[model samples]
Target: MSAELEGYEQDYAVLTAEITGRIGKVPRLVGDEKKLMILNVEKQLDEARELLEQMDLEVREIPVQSRSMYSNRMRSYKQEMSKLDTDFKRSRIAYSDEVRNELLGDDGNSSESQRAHLLDNTERLERSSRRLQAGYQVAVETEQIGQGILENLSQDREKIQRARERLRETDTNLGKSSRVLTGMLRRIIQNRVLVVILGIFIVFTIIMAIYFSIRRH
Candidate 1:
């Protein structure tokens, strides 16, 4: 391979490794962050593939007896890249599959967890309310010492209420993000399949052209 081709191959290899590493961890990631990471890696892979395709065309134009050898090398590089691309796609699908199950809450575990938390908080709030009422009555019946206790309980209740609101907002955001991610993943998979189909058509066209040319000669 030419120095330029060698350099391109090296860059492709490095990029593939980087992308593969990120994809491997996709299952561990969640929400929009995971989608963003996949998109970034996909962009990088696209740029690298474009460069490789350019190199492939250039290699095919080399006017020498060893042109066939160079072409073989180019094909090898493209095959490697194709395998890497497939692997990356499989990783993405695997991650999406895992996250889809989580989103569906297949076992009701997530709902159960949320229910348990709500129940716990409700019980705590009930207890706090009783204490506050008792403290208010104590203050009315006795001295002003219960006023201070009531104030503390009121502050605690406000904090807990704010926390629950924040938790609900977070859950809503996560649900929205998951739905968006699933849509994006489906679109990506469809596009990839279309690309593969288009590639096959192009290859078939090329073979036919070459075959007709040989027959005419």
Candidate 2:
């Protein structure tokens, strides 16, 4: 698997474990049917985690030899973006600083033509700065968007783990209850034929009493 993808998987598993371990204690401690809702949530979480893991595996199957290759690529893209952005900002700052210096009458050692030429330089600088700044902003925004997606995936993994823990607790409780109920039912119905015959006899007796009272009246 690709290193980046493996990193993502490890991160997801760790975060998921942490979140579920925190939330999963409630059902285990309480041991109530009311907490059964937690079981449903747990199932949903399990499915989501499975899906995410599968997706990660699928994405990482491309098999790259070096982990740093992708890291280097990402790092280079980010560095380039940062450098460009900084250069644009510095250019803008320099333009303003030059203008301020000139306006303050620091061009005393120069002629009017040279001073006018400074404005020309400033105009070009301003335009160049704006273009570079725009590109830089775009790059930063894209990086932020990518980070946000990673955070979201992590959050999803967390949700699923919590759910799985809850469902497990519920299943344990459910198994216990099922066994108890089965035993109770079996005990109550131990003498099935005798109970049925006794019930029929009592019903017959009641009917006979009712008939005899009516005839005497």
Candidate 3:
């Protein structure tokens, strides 16, 4: 599961970076408001992607019994992400088509109707381009956010592993302490028994001396 998520994140990052870099290069070609809107969309996409990545991280941390809920939510988020990609591509293609048609129609004609047509197509192209630009920004931000999240998750795994190793070491130390205590207790019992035997022998010797002295008297 971890490997799959990592692979997906890597691919997402690469694709997103390429798309966003491409859009960023075209800032000169787009209006200021369109560019700002695109950047805003990029931020939103980053947040959305961060949200999804956090959930996936939680899935790994949560108990096995409750992972199904997160898994379902992830699936839904994935569907939404896919839809966003589709809409983005579709809008770009549409805008490109409009621009191509407008260019083709601008062949030395100076009629009022031709000017109006150009104006209309130009407006349409701008709108479509803004939409496309926004989507592109969003896609790129998503990948960046995803890559960041994966890195965090990796760090958390390392922490958990280190904690487990410490716990094992503690258990081993406790076992050694227990054996040492047992050996000490065994020696204490043996010393007590030896003391008792020595005391009995001293008492017997004194009693025998008293009995012989009384008989002599």
- Per-model TM-score on C-alpha atoms: 0.43, 0.34, 0.46
Error of 3 at 133 (Å): 1.6
Off by over 4 Å in 1: 96-101, 106-217
Which structure is stronger by TM-score: 2 or 3? 3
- For 165-208, candidate 3 gives per-residue lDDT tens digits of 99999999999999999999999999999999999999999999
Evaluated against the true structure, the overall lDDT of model 1 is 0.71
RMSD of each: 44.1, 26.5, 14.0
Backbone clashes in model 2: 2
Candidate 1, residue 20: lDDT:
74
Residue pairs with backbone atoms closer than 3 Å in model 1 (clashes): none
User: How many pairs of residues collide in each model?
Assistant: 0, 2, 0
RMSD of 3: 14.0
Which scores higher on lDDT, 2 or 3? 3
Backbone clashes counted, model 3: 0
Sort all candidates by TM-score, best to worst. Answer: 3, 1, 2
